[model samples]
Target: MIAPAAAVTTVPRSVRLGYGVGSFCTATVGAVPGLLLLYYMTNFLAVPAWLAGVVVTAPKVWDLVVNPLVGRWSDRTRSRLGPRRPWMLAGALTLPVAFFLVFAGPSLRGVPAALYVGACFMAAATAYALFEVPYKAMPGEMTHDYHERTSLLQWRMIFIGAGTAISGVLAPAIAGSQGAQGTLASYRMMGLTIAVILLLAMLGAFFGTARAPMTGAPEPDRGGWREQFAAIKGNSAFLWITVLACTQMLAVSMMLAAAPYFAAYTLGDPRSTQTLFAALVGPMLLTMPLWVRLARRFDKRGAMILAALMFGGGTAAAMATPLFGALYAHVAILLVGVGIAGVQLLLFSMLADVVAADAAETGKRRAGVLTGLWTAIESGVSSFGALIFGIILSIGGFVESEPSRPVRQPESAVTAVLIGQTTVPAVIIFISVLITLKYRLRPPAAPAPAASG
Candidate 1:
């Protein structure tokens, strides 16, 4: 078991900053696909809505299997560069190429184009799993300090907000050049730009954490795959946190996937997507400190509950946009942003605590196994969210708009967009709040001092 003092020791500012930089890449990777991929295929490439959903969901399904394997491999790894950094470096080299292929595929329509995207996105998701599972495991290894973990994740959320803002605004702007929404050329440009940013940010994390200490206990045995499964199955706290986080992730994913459609049809201004995303993400940057303070004063679980309510309420209220207009809707979305910041800032911190408790109990470090399950649930649930929304869009009979021509959507399709943007997420977030209420974790005990020499 790690001593309390060792667990509570403060992380250096430099190491914190270096680890935090990785979130920039993560946010870009998450936001672009959630926000644009469905739109890109259905509207830009003229793929059917159901097929587009398949393209988006297939890669994540692959992650369900790959993440755990990578996690277990990372756990057993022994290296001079440390168990995690090598994987981070490998991800830095491969993720850019995989991401580029997602939007830069051959100009083929129908099933062929859809198949191409599915294959490329599967590659991207695999590369991301290589980096993310190990990266998430690092915070637990970095420090056992309860509050310090939250503090570290707070820095990560800041960059997540920044990266989301950049990708949300710039990607759409580039893709919708001169109000010509869903141009293939625009998507290609956006993909190239994001690919470069992903490579740089990931490499920064790799080199930055290169010399940082590895705090996880040395592997006791070469844990088998069955042992990894048993480890996660036995940890109740891990299960609850995974459920809560993935549910929230599902709600957030739905909103992200629905944003473009809502702006195009419900708000009557597709160009407003840039501003809408700004409103949803900008306040998150400013309010992250406020959420951090709340966590310090209260508990992380309490803070997360409050934020979930705010998110659900704000999303429900935003449905009244037709009555109150775009300005009013933006205000509602800003409230949702506040909730988003709280969840993003605290969930991983809580996960780190869970990892610590598991290590203390088992006397073996298995951060990789736990974090692998975490990332897998997040990826799977979020991708499932996209699939659900795509089915809704198809049911509503959404029309695929041409780049140089307008397409009229049915009234039902517009209504479907409204429901996806508001009611669906509102309901999902409410459920997440309920599940979070069941979480039970107290701060780890402080370690006793050593005997006098």
Candidate 2:
């Protein structure tokens, strides 16, 4: 069994770049819904708040069952194209199908709506898992170099930041132009466009590194599912990383699901959702290179702590929206987005490192299982965010059919929504930071930085 010590050389730049692009567009499959689906259900399609929440959350069950299987299958797969590319091709082609269907408006006003939306979401979830799980595992296959992996992840975040901004800004605009019902049409267009982008990225990754050196398979000592399970269960670092990753995803999901409602009812600017989103993310794009520099100087864990605190502080500042009005609230939220970008970017890098560390210890390249388990946990977090927020809204005196106007609720209700989106997540992110502190993996003294293929 070879230990992936700090002595590994850096990943090549071209491989890292190619992987980053493909992964970014594929990841958009997961993130696009988080940004727009809630808006579609609540305002455009006219689903009730409670029902909308359920519709939003119902697909995660598939994630738990499907994601791991795909991971395991990828781990065991032997192909001329490589373990990940075949699935990547299939995912890129199929993703648009599920993406288009999710926005197909069936009057989700009653049982029929619930069933319809639930079915659509399930298809989309499965498609996303197919695309995302394998897509995520590619970085590990791309390089064994520690610093080079970080560089690859850094480039990945750069592209992810760009794609996410476009999708977030465009989804609502396209839908709004066609009217709320036309939101479905807008969604269809977005899917087709993203699918094309993802396809191009897939092509890059597939062809760019065809001649590159391949990573060796798992050691003979590691055999079958039981061995993989033992490796993960026994690895304390992997366990903690999964927990922290899930919690972080949960915090993000709640905010993504809740932001639409908060913008419409709380801030009273439904149109401003895009503006707020852009404000939040645009700065992140501009500031990411700075974050990359900071990560190099201070380490990813410390940067994550700074980001969490910044996000928490921004959220706390936004709580004063009633006093200062929407303008100030928007600025505060923008700051929150900037903070979140660092966390989002760093989390991917951390996961890659964790995968590397696991392989080093376990003597198996179980990247598929690790990525699979990570996706499964994230799926749970996504569903939990939707479910818990729905329950919270019901308790907060939020009524589904009530016009978009703000309603008087118990102080607790307002406080609850605010805290759920802000304070709760802030606390969680902070706790995640504490947990990451437990990681003692140090990079090589002269570590080779990760790069794109």
Candidate 3:
């Protein structure tokens, strides 16, 4: 049987733009929290490294449950605004407010402060799930053509680069330095700024995709997720892609979490956080079109392998930052940024394919569960990167300090930060390259031409 919308070869550029605009939500939310939140908790709030890790990660644990439920709920809904947009709208209303409170509330340090931040972060995570799981579900439903999905996701990659660039560079500038000393007010302001950006992007996507086609059938899976899990268990391509995405995201998250520490201790300049991010996101922005072409030439599998190797090698080389100095580290990270473009584009594009293929085969609306599980894995491992780095810092005896009470980090802490950012993530990313080899998503064959009378 022909799949739904199989004959629809192209998504309108406007709808692509509208859908792609939502990535600002993912990139901004993902980059800012990973970049600054751990540092914010340890330095500004005086939370211990291990506990700060918990504050960053605990909220994401909530995702493993909530994301799937949101996915399932959307699959069942029949609404005038459509199932996904309503959830997107709800998230837009709630996340910005919750995100602002994360940094703006309760100046008290230690456990009291940690609890306040943790609760706010949990709320933000839930809000993110509301939009993100449903948002993720849309690309697969938008069209069925394999290459068209890549073309569609090309827009998302560009927007992701922009959002990541804005958040990565701007957040550090707004949050002050690593110590952030005596400038809690600046951190609060940064939160407000990021919140506003999130609001605008989410709302823009809602309005932008005003005429997006809902090609996927809305026959909700009545059986619980156990049935969906069984379906996923048999799907090898889906499983491998999930592994690749999760491992890569974990590495990215670890590096993002360690950026502030690396700038201050390893590079001897806290301001270099902005410079490092500029280098990182600059390459990401400039190379996205190149990566999209590479996906076409090499196929997503070969392209992913190349991208993973580039990221791992560049990140591993960055471990020598102390020996080579700032320029060398910057150049190495720039190379890593190039790989990041392909990694994200291919991963997202392939995900849409696998989900769409599954929906076509089963003749059920299981994309929600599939995407829910994917997001849960993505969100879980991504946040786990922070937890892993916090463990590394604790082992190195890093000290926590209030904004008014600055303290020197031991050489051991500095070394730990460098290793956490470079060596650990490099190894993890290389592991993803191996998993990428296991992915074998076959593109659907084109329909036969009609015979002449």
- The top-ranked prediction according to lDDT is 3
The stretch of ten residues in a row with the least summed lDDT in candidate 3 is 1-10
Global lDDT scores for all candidate models: 0.86, 0.69, 0.88
Which wins on lDDT, candidate 2 or candidate 3? 3
TM-score of every model? 0.96, 0.87, 0.96
Q: Clashing pairs in model 3?
A: none
What would the per-residue lDDT of candidate 1 be over residues 372-396, giving only the tens digit for each residue? 8789878898888788899999899
lDDT string, candidate 3, 1-453, tens digits? 224454765788999899989999999999998999999889878899999999899999899999989998988877998878998899999999999999898658899999999999999999999899889999988887777888889899889989999999888888883344327888898999999999999999999988988777557677776777888899887888888888999999999999989998999888898889988888666887788788879888998999989999999999999999999999999989988888999999999988888878777887778898899988887889999999999999899987666898888998999999999999999889888878878665566899999
* 392: Cα error in model 2, Å: 1.6
Candidate 1 steric clashes: 1
Q: Encode model 2's per-residue lDDT on 1-453: one tens digit a residue.
A: 124453454567776666667655544664677766765665555566678777787788678888888887777777897776677677766766666666665444545766777887788777667767877876665566755666667777777777767766676566555642345566667656755665676567556655544453454233677876787787776677677678777877777777766666667655666777787777666877777777888887787778777776787787777788888978898888888878777777777777776666656667878889888877777567866776787777664442343345566656566666666666766676677677555554553689979
Each candidate's clash count: 1, 16, 0
